[model samples]
Every structure is written in structure tokens, then in C-alpha cells.
Target: MSAPLLIFADTILTGFDPDGTPILLEQAALLIRDGRIADAGTADTMRRRHPEVEAMGGRGKAVIPGLINAHHHVGVTPFQMGAQDHPLELWFAERLRMRDVPPDLDTLYSAFEMVASGVTTVQHLHSRAPGDVTAVLDRANRIIGAYDRLGMRVSYSFAMRDQNRVLYDDDQVFLELLPAAMRPVAARYLAGFGLSLDEQAQVFYELRNQHSGKERIAIQIAPANLHWLSNAGLEMAARLHDATGAPMHMHLLETPYQREYAARRGQGSAVEQIQRFGLLGPDLTIGHGVWLSRDDLALCKENGVCICHNCSSNLRLKSGTADLNAFLATGLPIALGIDEAGINDDRDMLQEMRMALTLHRPSGHHSPAPTAAQVLQMATRHGAATTPFRERIGGLAKGQAADLVVLDWDRVTYPWQDSRNGFADVLVRRAKAEAVAQVMVAGRTVYADGTFVNVDRKAELDRLKKWQSRPRTALDEEMAELADAAIDVVHDYYKNWR
Candidate 1:
């Protein structure tokens, strides 16, 4: 057993209240024992109460709940590769052409980036694996094992998309529009991937039964997106969610084209369609509601559904900005996610928080614009609610998991050191990955002093580099050309949509 730890910080931000008020405490200290927070209070009080505990952190540092990434993907950052700014539909095609690496390396690469940015938990929505049922399940296990080795808390979900792999609607029309030479290639690409809804559900149940009690790992369901699934597939999602009470995460109306598609297909909106499917509830979290209307927001609010705003990914994919102000007005819970498409092309939650704070400010002064405190909550507490880790993490309360980020206040609060300047505001506004001095999860130090403690990140990265240098297959070359040929057709499909 590890010795009890008393962490002292110049200040602590205990996240935000439901009304968006900051809970700032000064001269605070946290008492950790048996991987949980034993107590949190003023440093003097904690020191008096627990005189025997060893201490960490001191003056010139601030501590907060570890950031929660409510939405992300495993082993994929499209913008960093050749897939640059394009609409979500076109970007999907471009991403198909990117090189592939081992799933374990891909998972670890992103996990390191997230931890360096003070994120301790991530909701990893795993994309479809290229294999039969057993192979896909094995790949999921590999991703989970990578996280386990890194000591990062992750909610893993097998992304379920049973239809509409290419365009918002029938992909056959788009395939036909491709050159005759590429027609066969496109068909094979679509057919070769993806599992039936039944197969996906079976895998989910099997994995959940096998790994349910594992430490720091939670299995959930992801329907991919509104247009990606058939009605039967969505029903399966609802059933699995009901059976396991596992949280559900899905992309909804991420682009204007998706909004149009939803309206046409459902005779109303995507939110309404989801409501009809019995999938709207506290357990359901919409990944990116960038194009949700006021009525849709109202429905989400009524159903207790949450939204994870991927501010950077929306901008990178040219998806319209989500009106976070509107979501907040409806009293809906909002969380933050990098979605593997951060503006810096890295999974930096601090940078994402800064962007989210500035992106939603109205031109004129408003009564309730997004505050720095609210953004901090979105990155920390609100995000935890989106996963099963909600009760255990998201705060430094008694009996909660000892997950937190310690920042070098001297590095962040330089040039101005007034206590009245609001530590939460300063940290959110100016802090970067460099300010993250240490990250702890479950009373264990996972990262400290500019290196990971649990695993050799350098060696893992070297393995990835070697894998990337390997020769590309014939399918890789064909997919690159096929993606280029299909981009124009995808653009035209949305352009002419009624």
C-alpha cells in the first residue's frame, strides 16, 4: 500500500456549480488515501488534521480536477495527416486514405497527448475495425490494454454505424458517380468494412460481460451518428443501453448537411427522430450538436440529454459553430471534447478550453455569455457526467477518486500575481500544456516532471514511427485515388440537397 499523500496548492478550483459559478478555494490541500480523496480543505486545516501524511505540491502551484474529454476517437487525428479542412462528409473520404498503424500504438499516442494536457479521463469512441467479429473484439481489447498500461481512465465504445458509410443517404448513387474504373474499388471499400447491427450488439454484450469489473475501464455504446445508422440499428442501441444501463454517445447534426438530411429523412429534425426511438435520456450524450435548432435544444433539455462541444473539430471540419449559449440557456449540461481534431493538431485540453471560451462570446454584451469558470467546468466536471466515471471523478470531494492536475502557477500566473485576479480565470485563459507539472489518477502519479511514470512513452512512439515507415499496400494507393474521385460527388450531393 502507498503512503497517504497530502497535496498542497496555492489555490484550487473545485469546478463549477449548476448555475455556472466558480467554486474557488485558496490555500487548499487534498488528503488522499487508498486511491480516493480522504478530505479537502484549507491547507492549515488539512495539515492540522493529517499531520502524519506526506505532502506534495506547495506554494506557486494550483490544483484542479483532471480534465475530462467527453468525446474522442482511438488512434486517429485526420487533420494532422493529409486530411485537412473539409466538410465532415468530404473529410471522411480524405481520412480513408491516411496510413494505418498498430491499434495499440495509435491508442497510446493520443493518450499521452491528452495526459500531457492535464486530461485524466477520455471517452474513446472506437471506429470500425477491419476484420471479422473476433478480430474486431480483439482490436477493442488491445486498445483497452494500451490505456490500462498508461494508467489513463477511459470509457470505450464500439462505434456502431450500420448504413450510410459514404454519403448522408444511399452511397450507391455516389459510387456510380465515380469514374467507371473506381466503381468496383468504392463498392469493395464500403462492403468490406462494417458489421451488422446484430454482430455489433453481440460484441458489446460479450465485451461488457468480460470486462465490466475491470479497473478504470467502462464500456458504452456509440451509434456513430444520426444518418449513419438504420432504424433497426438504433433500436439495438436503445436495447443495449436499457440492458446494461451503459451510457450512449452519438454524433448529432454536426454539419448543416446533416441537419438537412435529418429533416428530410425524419420529416422533422434529428433530435425528434431520436426521441421517437426512445434513446433520449440522461444516459445519452450527443457528441457535436453544432447545427441543433432551438426546438432541438429544448428537447434535449427536457430529456436530460447532454452535449459535448468539440469546438476545434467543428472548426477544422468546417462544421458550423455550436451555439453553446443556447444550450446553456436551456439548462442543458455541456461538456468539452477534442475529438482528435484540436486546432493545434494535438490533444491539448487547455487549448480547447481557451478556444471554447472565446468562440461563443456574442458580438454585444450578453447577460450570460460563457465564462471562464463555465469552460473549466465543461472541461472537468460536466464532462465526467457523460461517462460512468461521473460519481468517482470530476471533483476533489471526500471519497471521490484522487484524480487531479497540478499546474505550475508561477509559469501561468507570471507578469501579474494579484490574488484578486481570480486563479480560475487566469488558469483557463493563459495556461497551456507546459503548465501541467503533474497529473494523478486514482492516487497514483501517472505523469510528472515532463515524463510519463507508468509507461515508456518514447519507446511506444518509436514503435509507431517504425510502423509508419513501412510500405503501403495496393489497397492504400487505390483508396487514395478513390477518395479523391469521390470528394467532388460528395460536395455536389450536399450542394443539390433539397
Candidate 2:
């Protein structure tokens, strides 16, 4: 933390505190010493605080906290866009099958887009191929190195599942499991979900056993499904939680069918079962609680359980939108997520925020939708609070990790204070990826005025594109291929889902 890295902005959007407050230090200067914010005030005060400070100049710029993307599947391929819209279960299965089998570049491009759009922190709910955790780890190392260069804060967990096989071992039963009519429809449903139990454990064990930095490698747990996991699997999940004190993540209550599975198994609710098995608390971050009832939301609030709200994914997959109003009414912490590949196209959180604003329109209920400020709160403050790193990141405050974004207001021209335009509303409606001016991570400029600091992006993309284009060999194609076909068939069958 260098003392007095002097920075000035037209307006510095400070959400650095526990509450996401907008502190507009107009014409003010901030001095970051070493990396901590040493002092901030009018130019006069800052100068007095740091007489020998170096100046980083900027004018007419909007500075805000670097975004924290609470949920993402890093190995998102271009082919992953094959399944446009589908339900929850099928969507996950498709994702599971299509993982890191795709080229590493496809994933890199998606991540680059996220950072480019001003996302400075991301929690990757990643999936990788089995018997090849190292391959996935190697891939992850590449990605993390890139993130380091871009100065992004990232926490990664393997998308995990050891349950389905544990419960039902027969191939025919699995094939006949999904409705025959829905098979073709569901094919397009799944793609790049995450890794299996074996894969997840291997990755976790390796990361925990090997990682050396608090900032670099963070161990994470993802229990893919309660029904498929054996008692042993649950114990393993708990073991991970107990052993490393790392974070645990999963998808909970995103579909009606998941609830049906719980009912059939006499397990009440997946979240409840998970909680009973010691999987709830400040460390557990559940993604897409779109279908959770008020009671379920309350359980989360009571336990300090944070949820990653994937607004675009829920809408696109017809999983139903999270009742954000009810959730807020519960005082439950919530973070924004762009389900892998993104809601409409690409890994753009700005677009995700916009979709969240308008998706819950009643047939004509007519209420004022939430504002950009509201959604931004979820993405930055609430999102930061979801992970174990909450104390370190998520807002623009002195002494907080120096993670932030600078907006290009000159090009954006958004503050058209007309009859219907507020600056906040304009930011939500009109802000584009092009308007993201610069990004800083850990007090260093990772992305400045549209250039990344890490790896050679052009060369990296070229290699990944070439690698993805090459087909998987017959010997290497067994499980994931079968999974992909199943997902494709299921998605196609349910193309016109009710």
C-alpha cells in the first residue's frame, strides 16, 4: 500500500463502508499510501496530508468501486450459446457436460469482457473435466494469471456433483429419467456447468494443499445436488468446510423440479437439508434463489446466508425471477450474478443490472422498478459480503483493498437531466462496455483506458481459438460427449417450454 497515490475525479462514488453510500467528493483528491487509502479530502487537505505525493491526473471522470461479480462459470465456450433458453435442471446438466472441453480462449474472452465492462472481482463457479484436474488447474492458473495482470479479485470453486451417480447407478434409468418428450428439448439446456465430485475434491485438495497466497488461490466447495449425493458426499462437503474454513457455494431453489425432488425424497427443501448438514452461514453463498419462498429467504437472513441472484439466467432459462422485493423485505444479503456466457450475450454485468431492472413487469401491475443505484448495491456491496473476502473488497473506501473503476463520462454523455433522465437512470439505461475507462485492482492499474496489463491477450486468444477448433479424440470424448448429447436432446425437446 503505497502512501499517496494521488487520484482525483469529477465524482468519486464511494460505497466503501458497510452500507453502500455514495460519497461525492467533488473536486476532491485521494491519497493511497502503499495501497491503503491514507487520506482523502479537498485538494488542500490531501496536499497537507501527503506533501510528497505523486499525482495521477484525471478530470471529469466518474470513479466507483470495482464491480464484484458473485457468480460465473469461467469455461464458457462460444458453443455454449447453443442453448438459448431452458429450465433449471436441464440447464445445469447441459452446463456440466460442456465444460473445459471447449478451448481455454473461449473462457478467456468471456472473462475479458467482464473486466472490460468494469467488473474487478469475480467468483468463478467453475467446472472442469474429470481424471484431469491438473489440466483444469493449469487452465485456471492461466486464467488467474490473466486476472492478476488485469488486477481482478477472483475466488474459484469447482461446480460439484457426486450425488446423481451415488443415488442411481444404472445407465438405462438415467436415460429414461427425464421425460421422453423433454429429452430433445433439454439437449440445449446444459453446457459448462462445473465439475463432478471426484473432480471437485481433487481440485479442492490440490488448491488447499498447494496454494500459497491469501489473494491468489482460494479454496471453495460446491455441492451440486442433494439428491444425487450419498451420505458420504455430504460428509465430504462438510469435511471441506471444516478442514479449510473455506467458502462453500451451490445452486439452491432455482427450479420447481428441485423442490419436487426434495419432496419425493422426503427432504423438505434442499437448502434446509444442506443447512442441517452444516452447510449454511457466512461462508455459504447460494446462487439463483429464484424459487425460494419467504420462509426460505428468512432462513438465509437468519443465518447470514447470502444469495447470488442471477437475474438474466433466471429470465432466459424461464426459471422465474428472484422476488427481489420479498428478499429485500427479509433483510437477506443479495449479490448480482451473470449466469455463465451471460444473460443476453457475453459477460457484461452492466447489461445484467439493466435486465434486473425491467424483467419483473407484471402483466400491467405498474410499479416503479428498482433503480440503477439499487441494483448496483446488490452487485458491489451485497456481492462482496457473500464471499469470505467481504472484509477486504467490494467498495471504494480508504483502507479497503484498492479495487475500483474509472468511468469515461466524456464519451458516455449520460447525465441528460431531462424530464425522464436522472444520472443514475442514464447509467443503467445507456452505459455501454465502451464507457468503462480504467480498472484498478489491489492499488495497481490492471486495465487502463481499455488496455489490460496481464498476458498478451491477442496471442492468448489466438492459441485458445486454435485449441478449441481441434476436435476431441474418441478416447477422450466418452463422458462429456454423452452429457452434451443428452443436454442437446433435452433442450431441443423442450424448445417451447410451458
Candidate 3:
């Protein structure tokens, strides 16, 4: 019946705008009704007209769009806590072992850390480990629904692949083809590589029916990798995209080794292959496209396919830093991600941005570093675009949701003397998570003044620490328990390539 009043002082990082030009609106005021921004302008103007509204004194805080996490395997296995510094294959093995832990409260706690880090939205490629699929979906829904009530946007993707089932049939074939000593290693490795085409598609279609378009949840496709997926799987993904109208968050060229293997096997590059499958389109987003050629980037631009740049995760796993300049220069849509709950051993976008900036130091040429403003935008506006929620929550503007994060200028973005100094610069580099003065989701202060109103932090974290993680064979220790283990596995898998 009446307009809800909201006001801010000094500055507001208007994340996006109706005019298509997002800008910083100073001393701005906003009026929200039914959870969406009704209008915005100078504080004095709006407060005068909407006289009966409540006031939230800005007290010199900078209001910006709530952060978005574009790529994450949120229910990371606890043993995944300390990832072995390895390439993609070993990383996947560690993830497989991580999945050995039972999914329960521990899974949701991973999502909690994302939220507490000022990540208001997350896109998770749900683990497809051999677990109760129905139970996994059930817990996945519960996790997302919690965020829905908490006023955060979530996009959950089922990690679908035909190779979830052991790709081979008999040990006799492997025994005849390989040395007797290596048969056990080869068998177990291939066995861990699982889902048959029929079963994978069945699981995917079932998940599509259960989650997509239901109560703010959307389905996405995570075609696990090149070796495992079949043509049937890709076709089903396209059909699912049409039926549910959700995005496809596929993993592509995460490592050079995968690309070389595909070439050696005559499977073609993963990018080139997916394109031929008719799966590349606007709803398609590829993660860790590190080996992308200029042609690949152009194809992505031509098809309007976006890339989720997982900077920190890429570096941590030695996958190489994302080609930031190349991606930006292509003029294609790009989004940012931490890629894991405690990715790069941190929980906040601020840290991720910093890493994304410095890791790819240009050779022979240097200039002004990428600005904090641009990095923040990728994490917010661009990251939000990873899902349909972009139009709803990525920006601070009239008719946008009032979801925003207010920073404590004094403590974190220190020496905030004049706006002329570009306050945003300080915030991008120096601000601490504790300095997040207030966080609003859909016009409600879910987290304010260093405390969360929607979920109990202590309780959620306690639940995680208390998850009674499965016995002794932790990936952290055994992932590379002996130097020879990795050397042996690599020799078995890659010797043919050489």
C-alpha cells in the first residue's frame, strides 16, 4: 500500500542500470516495494516525497551489488579441504575420494561459507559421485531452499556424464593389453571413472523433472569431461535446455593434458566437439577454458556462450591462470568464480579478485593494473549473469532488487577521506569480510553489523566440524602419499601421448 524507504550516503555502486550504463550514484536514495527497487535518486528528493518511510542512515558506507559466485562444487568432500597441488586428473581423483564422505549437513555448511563471504548467489555443479541420486537431489533442494529463504539466488547443476559406470567390461581385456603389474591400478582407475549412457541420461532427466523451474530452482548441465560423455548425453542436454530453459555450465579444456589426449585419440578438442554436438548456444557456459584458442573465444562470442573464469581454483590446481585480457578483449560475456567453498584457501570475492588480478602478470609489457572496480563488477554483475538472476539482483538501480552489501569504510577501506580518491579502489583491494557492515537480500537485512539474521553461523560451522568425516584414508594425506603414486599413474595414463 506504501513505498518502502531506503537511503544511503556519500556513494552507491549502482551495479547496473535501465539506461545500459551502470554508474556510481552519490548520496542516492532508493524506494523499495514488494522486494524490488521502485525508484532511486538523491536522498533529499525521495525522502521528501515518501514522508512516512523508515530511514537507514548510510553513515558513509558504500553500497554495491551483492557478490555472485559463478562456479562451485559446494558440497566439496571434507578431505578436499587441502587439495593436492596437482593437475586435472589427480584433482578429479581427489574430488572422487572427497565424494566418498556422506553428504548431509556438511554439504550445506559449504554453501553457508559462500554466503557469509558476501557471495549472495552461487552456481554449483552438484557432485555426481556414486551416491543415492534421489537423496543427493533431496539434500541439494534443501540446501538451495535455505538460500531462497535467506534471499540469495542459487543455480544448481547436476554433474551428468555417461562414464559414471566403469567404462570397461572385463579385466581380461586390460590384462591382455597392459603389463600384469599395472592391471590392478588400471582396473581401479577405470572403475572409478563411472555412469553408463543410459543410466547417466536417466539420472539427468530425473533431476530435470525434479528441480528445474520449481520454486526458483533451475537445472544446469555439467558434462563431466570429454572422455566419458557420449553423443546421446549431449543431445539430452540440448533437449533439457529447451524443456527447462536453464543454462548449461559445462567444463571445457580445464587442462592441456585433456586436450592432448583428445587429439591423440582423434576425439578432437573438447570445445570443437561440443560445438559439433549442437550444444553451444546462449545458455551454454564453459568453465576453465584455459586452453581456448582465438578461434574458441571467437566461437564463444559468436554463439553468445559465456565463460566462468575460476581464477583462484585454476591457480591452486596449477591449471594456469585464466587468460583474463584475452577473454575481456574478445568482448564476450565473462563471469568470476572462487570455484570452491574455501577456494584458494579463502572465502571472499575480495581475495579471489586480488588473485585473479596479479597471477597473470603480462610479459614485456606493463601498465596500470586491472581496477578493483572492474574486478568487483565481474564478481557481481558478470557473475550474476551466470544465471537468469542477472536481471534481478546484479545491479543497484531503480526497479532492481534492493539486495546489496554495505561496506564499513572506516575500518577496511581505510582513510576514506574524499570521494575524489575513488573510494571504490580502496574497497576493491583492502576491505576485509568483517568490514561488511550490512548485507541485504531482496530488501531484507539478512546479515547486518557483523551478524547473520537468517542462519546461525556458529551452529552451521559446528555442524561442519562435527560431520564425523569417514575414516582414515583422507585425500589430503593419501592423494600423493608416495611420490611414486603420482608418477606411476601419470606414466600409465600419459605414456602413450609421449
Task: Please give the CA lDDT of all the candidate structures.
Answer: 0.86, 0.67, 0.66
- Clash count for each candidate, listed in order shown: 0, 38, 7
- Writing each residue's lDDT as its tens digit, candidate 2 over 1-498 gives 344588777667667334433456776776766655556787667767777878775676777777888888754543453443556556555553443444346556766888888887888776543345667677666656655555567776666665443112323344565556544433332223235556667777886666547563465677756655656777788888898888887787777665666655666677787877888888888888777876777788888887888887777777776787666555566788886656656788888878877775445566545656667778788888777678677776777877777888666674543536545566666777898888777777777767777756788677876775777654335445555656655555445433
Q: Which ten residues in a row have the lowest lDDT in candidate 2?
A: 163-172
lDDT over C-alpha atoms for residue 147 of model 1: 89
Q: How do all the candidates rank in terms of TM-score, highest first?
A: 1, 3, 2
lDDT tens digits by residue: candidate 3, 295-392: 78888888888788888777767777668878876655678877763354645777777776666557665633455566776788777777766677
User: Which pairs clash (backbone N, Cα, C closer than 3 Å) in model 3?
Assistant: 162-195, 163-194, 163-195, 164-194, 164-195, 165-194, 165-195
Model 3 lDDT, residue 254, Cα: 78
Ranking by lDDT: 1, 2, 3
Clashing pairs in 1: none
lDDT of 1 by residue, 166-208 (tens): 8887777778778899999888878766677888998899888
What is candidate 2's CA lDDT for residue 152? Answer: 68
Give the residue spans of candidate 1 off by over 4 A. Answer: none
Best by TM-score: 1
Quick one: best lDDT, which candidate? Answer: 1
